[model samples]
Target: MTQDKLIRRVLKPVVWVLCLGPLGGLAWLAYSGGLTANPIEFLNRYLGEWALKFVIFALAITPLRGLTGWAGLTRFRRLLGLFAFFYVVLHLSSYVGLDQYFDWNAIWLDITKRTYITVGMVAAVILLALAVTSTKGMIKRIGGKNWNRLHKLVYLAAAAGCLHFFMMRKGVQLEPLMYGGAVLLLLGYRLVGYLKKRRRKSRLAVA
Candidate 1:
């Protein structure tokens, strides 16, 4: 098989394995006394980190394709985005189910009253909506133009997610700061590209 086909063939399974394998490994660590104390916090941290990582993955697609000219990466964006949703769900579940004991009212109060939680919840909702409508059937049903418009919301979702992470912590941490920086740089690349295109168009019009 050609290199491209080989890469494509292995991509899905590899991503799935890498994503879930860690969760299983962590669970095993907890069961075997590695995370004996405060396993719930460990689980929450893992899920939260994955959610932000997935957001970064989703955001990286356009920049990656733009920089490397590997258009095929666009095909994986949906899967990456859905994985972000999965992690966010897991993160929230860990809090609600494991932490809060399924207290609906308390959860509701936390969501509404807590600024960081509210931002994160809103971002998650937007990601979930985008993921649900990501399929071709939904695209056809919604119409391509409308779908495109809706998908643009991913940028806002990503920004909100980053900010949510930034605010959730009491003090600045290097790791999350790095994630935010990467998001900013990736987005900056797109902005610069747009300006370049605009400048070229203006120069042509003057000529």
Candidate 2:
């Protein structure tokens, strides 16, 4: 099959299933009494990790496509980004719906008092903006330049998310450090690209 057809017909569907698989497993665990004493905590952490993972994955797509010469990979970015948003929303839901039991007052206090929650909320809000504006209509309405400017916040959001995760954990966790490293790598790639582009422009202007 053609690359376009493969991306659209096969890869996309497979990715969709893989993305949803976590939630499905979580549900099954809860139903089967597999989650430990604190199911809410498990759900919250699991969903948040997956959300952050997808966000980082989305961030990595550009560099991957450029390196691998797979421009068609761009088609999957929106879906991946939206999945990041999906899992983030569910993460928040698990916190508020299951843990907080819809306690708005408590939730507000926690968000205000807890540094991790504050950062997590900020990241979530940023993801929400990105997700809402992911559509073609929204992109056109906002215009490409402004839309791109707004979407640049994804890096900040992902960085904040890594910080949030690290802060949430107690101490000496390799996982958060690895995530931080990954984010730096992806952002570093962009930085390199930007510098190269600027250099090229400078040479052209000089000529």
The top-ranked prediction according to TM-score is 2
Worst 10 residues of 1 by lDDT: 1-10
Q: What Cα-based lDDT does every candidate model obtain?
A: 0.85, 0.94
Q: What TM-score, computed on C-alpha atoms, does each candidate reach? A: 0.90, 0.94
Number of clashing pairs, model 1?
A: 0
Instruction: Give the runs in model 1 whose Cα sits over 4 Å from its true position.
Output: 2-8
Model 2, runs deviating above 4 Å: 31-33
Candidate whose lDDT is highest:
2
- Cα RMSD to native, each candidate? 2.0, 1.5
